[model samples]
Target: MATTNIWQQFKALIPEGVRVVATIAANNGNGTSQAELRDGSVITVKGETVNVGEKAFILDGEIKGTASSMAQYEVEV
Candidate 1:
């Protein structure tokens, strides 16, 4: 018989989600809104609390909450 390892068991549970910063582009006027990432790519996220032209934190295609306007920098070693 096969055995389930710790890593396998962990995978079964709800894993952590990845959050990204984005700016509100447009509001669908329902419960979702359009947001734009730093890369100039746009994505639809769920949330209308944040106004247009504002930054927010998106996770799992849902809006967790508003985000700061601090600048971001990529570093390489």
Candidate 2:
């Protein structure tokens, strides 16, 4: 008998949504920031001070929900 890994089997359970992989290109230093995504699209987020060069996840050009630092989702797999 072999043991099965539940994580591997359930990994697909993660919902697929609009996930933007981008880097903070600029910060206005006034609660506004801009990120340049891999797809060559720039999105703006206000009320958040994202440092330049910092990787971030943004959805719908807002960081209110479904957004956070990329480091937070790092998985040691």
Candidate 3:
């Protein structure tokens, strides 16, 4: 659980899994798929039915939902 405390009250921020955006590179066809992150790293995302080449929000190896397909720009600071 991701928690944050404000005024001595605890609140959960990211309920499950780390928030990450990845593109589905391959669908294993058994409810599991391989996703590629923005850094060109590949990871296996399980328990979500996803299509190839679709960007998705992954958490705890599960799909929270789809993400925007717009072009992404990173600023190096």
Candidate 4:
């Protein structure tokens, strides 16, 4: 069975421009392990699980995927 992280799945279900506080625990091999906000800053997530302390405001275009050719779609925070 494929196990995907809760943070990853939760982030994926949300639409753009929504304000969210999330903590990245594990990356699903897509390069990013944390939530990206509307801003232009890539925050590095650490640990196997995240809690209230690790929560952060979602930055714009911070979620980096495996698509190396999708650079044009990135938004500057």
> Tens digits of per-residue lDDT for model 2 on 1-77?
54388886687678655666577888777777888876778877764545677676666665443244544344697
Model 3 TM-score (2 dp): 0.75
The residue ranges of model 3 lying beyond 4 angstroms of the native Cα positions read 1-16
Taking all chains together, the TM-score of candidate 2 against the true structure is: 0.49
lDDT of 3: 0.81
Instruction: Tell me the number of clashing residue pairs for each predicted model.
Output: 0, 0, 1, 8
Q: Rank the candidates by lDDT, best first.
A: 1, 3, 2, 4
Better candidate number, 2 or 3, judged by TM-score: 3
Q: Residue 34 CA error for candidate 1 (Å)?
A: 0.5
TM-score of 1: 0.74
Model 4 regions more than 4 Å off: 1-16, 27-31, 34-53, 60-77
- Model 2: residues >4 Å from true position, as ranges? 1-17, 64-77
State the weakest 10-residue window (summed lDDT) of model 2: 64-73
The better candidate by lDDT, 1 or 2, is 1
RMSD list, candidates in order: 3.9, 8.9, 4.4, 13.9
User: Residue 1 deviation, candidate 1, in Å?
Assistant: 26
Candidate 3: count the clashes: 1
True-structure RMSD for candidate 1: 3.9
How much lDDT does each candidate structure score? 0.88, 0.66, 0.81, 0.44
